[model samples]
Target: MSPRKKIVQAAFEKKKLNGVVARVGLVLDISGSMRNLYLNGTVQEVVERILAVASKFDDNQTLDVWIYDNEFSRLPSVKENGIENYVAKQILNNETLHKFGRNNEPLVMEDVIRKYTKEEPSTQPAFIVFINDGGVVKPTKKVIVESSTLPIFWQFVGIGNSDFELLRKLDEMEGRFVDNANFFHLDDISAISDENLYDHLLHEFPEWLQAVKSKGLVL
Candidate 1:
């Protein structure tokens, strides 16, 4: 085997996933559309799995949860949520711009950008997972464009049948676009299973992670 393969094997033997991580910033679409049961579970199921898996990374990583909508634009900030807030503000910006409430208080995309441009932070390494139904309002594009430049690494997963085409397109050109790769996916939840989710996440997560780190970002 190659020397690199030998080294990795030895590392695995020693149970060292040093650079490989577990904690992550999970963003799910709690919009009205998510309630449309696409599979055995709604998009919520995926978020649950994400949280569960993060727990396994206890030694190396932690998972933070953030949900978005108008009245509930954020699911308690990750900062206050107790996990590292490296990407909290960026997620908040994307949340406000790229999301509308399922019920109340709509904050336009410009609002998020106007806020972010005024304050930029160090780009941290993070598994920015976006679970959305591409049904956001049109004007939100401004928010998307503005905040899109913020994240250093991402895992954009689209749930349901919302124009996967458009959703994938709005993503950064060099952005963390997963194009159905393991880290990223276009899931029709109705036809999926937990096992399927677990296996894919396990198999695909590592490589996408490697790609993100290759860019020289820190999580």
Candidate 2:
């Protein structure tokens, strides 16, 4: 059996999955920077990546997604929610970061983590794939402090010229994976071709998933 199959089984027996339910959450970044021609448009790149991953799962599996910049962006434009639609809608509108009452935007990774744990207690092994072209905008400590108690696995991929050292530092930590914690830092979008991008996603997904599973998560 596949790793995903094994995990679904183990998590079912343990009754720790959030929603008793959806096995995954793909949190994508639809920030202003993704509008550039980095990857056949940011939305296309992300949508394609997600679809590929999802295609590998069992037919019965379900996954939820959220795109964030200023506020949380949902997917599907009268269509299946994925990288493609999200990119076209959010990117074209250029409102990826339209937050209210805030002079500056904050990274929602920590908040999303807490919300998942609280709103969907049955959702286990809540994996958050945080994509960004900028900094978290919130303090590193705040990200951890604001996170939920649920065990969240983070996969962060940063684009653009922003400082990615911090994101890298978080992923490499030896302790428990915290609220703002994640897996990668692909800072220079200009450098990553389609092959490079897809390969990174394919390679990292298994490694991180396995490592997290080895730690014995409920999922």
Candidate 3:
């Protein structure tokens, strides 16, 4: 098996996310600053790793992929095999990061809220893997506070050497009804071990499950 596939399988066997999260959303950042990461295949690798993680959560073994810079667009649902090609096409497409403009992390969360509450509500708790490499600036604090009662968790992963000020703030942010977000720093994510990666990736999830259940966020 490929190293990526092995990581995925190992996560399923050791982590045992089965019956935990009912859905997985892999949110990718396509800002200009993120261009290198996407081009260098770091983002694709992360997608593959997350796809592996998602497989353990959802029965369909697929992930709802969303890309954003200042704006958000939901691409097609992707499985492990198609991740590389799917990302390649997006990166090599006419709409380059320069055209996409700023990196608005809040817009992605806004889309997530609209999708779940109005567009399609699911009682099953969702695990959102939000990837970015810089600071956030979208008044996401209010969004997280409002969505605190909803059945979803945001696991923010920071890539590259950029200063993730907003992510750090979010990690330490308070006043929410429940703790629904966690952050992980991956300066060079490609070099990280799958075991260590998965460990931190899923560290706070069980507590989130208990918290959400106590609040009746998921059924």
Candidate 4:
């Protein structure tokens, strides 16, 4: 096994998620402010790391990908074999989708909900990793609250120095059928070790799985 995949598998074992089966998706912030991260290869690294998690968690070993700014594009799904230069090939070089613009969380978020709940419904749960540098809006709360009962778990990661107030307060958000999201902040994702990063990424997921299973959110 690849080293990163081994690290992710170890993380799953540590979290007692050894037998869990789920779909994995990645949402990247392509807003104007994120230009540096993308250009510096940070976004590509993020894709590779998340793809490792998908290698272990997803039955098909594929990672569904989406990039969003004011608008969103559902790019082709990523498999471990094709992870080389994924961000550059799929997003930067691909002229078909919107590039860096302003942030609009609700639009892309709603589409993610539609994909998992309507287009390709599944008995297995979906674990979505949402990466944003900042500028999350209030409208996003409505989408998260409304999608609370669905078989999707949102793991929001704030990368950069932004306040991320709304993301930071996801746990305290009200009126959800269940707590469907978790948030963590990192000044620089690449600075973290693989083991530590996987630990943080999977931290709240097991609890969310237990809660959702008891509520029949996942079959």
Candidate 5:
């Protein structure tokens, strides 16, 4: 019922999403910098809004949720029921300092790529929403470039006032099979219009989907 939630749901409804091959994934940055966002409830609202979008994807309306700093840990999927309490508890109860001060995206990506490929091995492309405060390392760029050929689209949403220098560079850094990564530096996430935010969030995904399919990356 919040504006952000309305925007996410409306944007999803506006898209011709039927038959779109997608598996939803939400990656939350639990770094020390993100602690304030968690305390102030922005992260919870974000999870709920994204969960609203994820529900449209499958019968269970569930999304894979992961929290990462230098490493990553998979949490219970965000389902349609009790989502708010579920998300809040996950953030509130966790050790915020778990491998603190590091945002090794490559480690997380490797885990996701390996787990999904071996366990599921489906052709459905994954839409990974990576929430962070702009701590992408050099190896992340290499891993991203290497993984561009895989069936996954990475949308990096930068929260807070950080410059997101590396993320911006990654956005313009090219020569992949297709543009698999998109970046947004949000000055005030709560103030953003849902329409605009969702537009940015979903914009590059459809194109990437087509490109991957055409290249025989997604069968």
Candidate 6:
């Protein structure tokens, strides 16, 4: 097994998520402010790391990918087999895809909801890893609240030192059937070790899974 897969598996075992199954999705912020991160290969590294989690969590070992600014593009799903140079080939080289623009979290978020809840519809839960540098809008709260009852958990990660007030307050947000989201800030994601990163990523997921299952959100 690849080193990342081993780390992810070890994290799963530590979290007691050995037998859990879920569809994995990655939402990358392609807003104008995020241009540097993309150009510097930070975004590519993010894809590779998340793909490691997907390889273990999803039955098909595939991760559905989406990049968003003001608009969003649902790029092809990525699998373990062709993970190398994925961001460069599937994203940077693709002329048809959307790149840096403005931040519009709700637009892409709704489409993610549509995919797991409507288009593909699965008995397994959907685990969405949302990455952003900042500039979160208020409408994002509405989307998270509305989607709370569904079998989806949003793990929002803020990269860099920017104003993430709204995302930071997700844990306190109310009026949801269940708490369906988590937020963590990392000034520099690449600096973190894989083991620590995996631990942070999977931190709140197991509790969310237990809550959702008890409420019959997932069978």
RMSD of each: 9.5, 7.2, 2.4, 0.8, 2.6, 0.9
TM-score of each: 0.52, 0.60, 0.88, 0.98, 0.88, 0.98
Query: Which lDDT tens digits does candidate 4 get at residues 124-143?
Result: 99999999998498899999
User: Model 6, 103: alpha-carbon shift in Å?
Assistant: 0.3
TM-score, candidate 3, is 0.88
Question: Which of the predicted structures, 3 or 6, would earn the higher lDDT when compared with the native?
Answer: 6
TM-score of 4: 0.98
Each prediction's whole-model lDDT (CA): 0.45, 0.50, 0.78, 0.92, 0.77, 0.92
Across residues 1-219, which tens digit of lDDT does each residue of candidate 2 receive?
A: 654334434433343322332244566655565546334664455555444444333133444556666666544422233434555555455544452222122445545664666665642455455666666664644455444234555566676677666666664443445333544556554466544554454444444444555655445
Q: For candidate 5, lDDT tens digit of each residue in 168-189?
A: 8865787787889888878777
Q: Which stretches of candidate 3 lie over 4 Å from their true place?
A: 1-16, 94-100
Kindly report which residue pairs in candidate 6 clash with one another.
none
Over 45-134, each residue of candidate 1 has an lDDT whose tens digit, in order, gives 454456545544433435555556664333542332343333334443353444434722125233323322344343443444556665
Q: Report residue 156 deviation for candidate 4 (angstroms).
A: 0.4
Model 3 lDDT-worst window of ten: 91-100
lDDT for model 5 comes to 0.77
After superposition, candidate 1 runs with Cα above 4 Å error: 1-19, 36-44, 58-62, 70-72, 76-124, 135-151, 169-187, 202-205
CA error at residue 206 for candidate 4, angstroms: 0.6
Q: Can you list the residue pairs that collide in candidate 4?
A: none
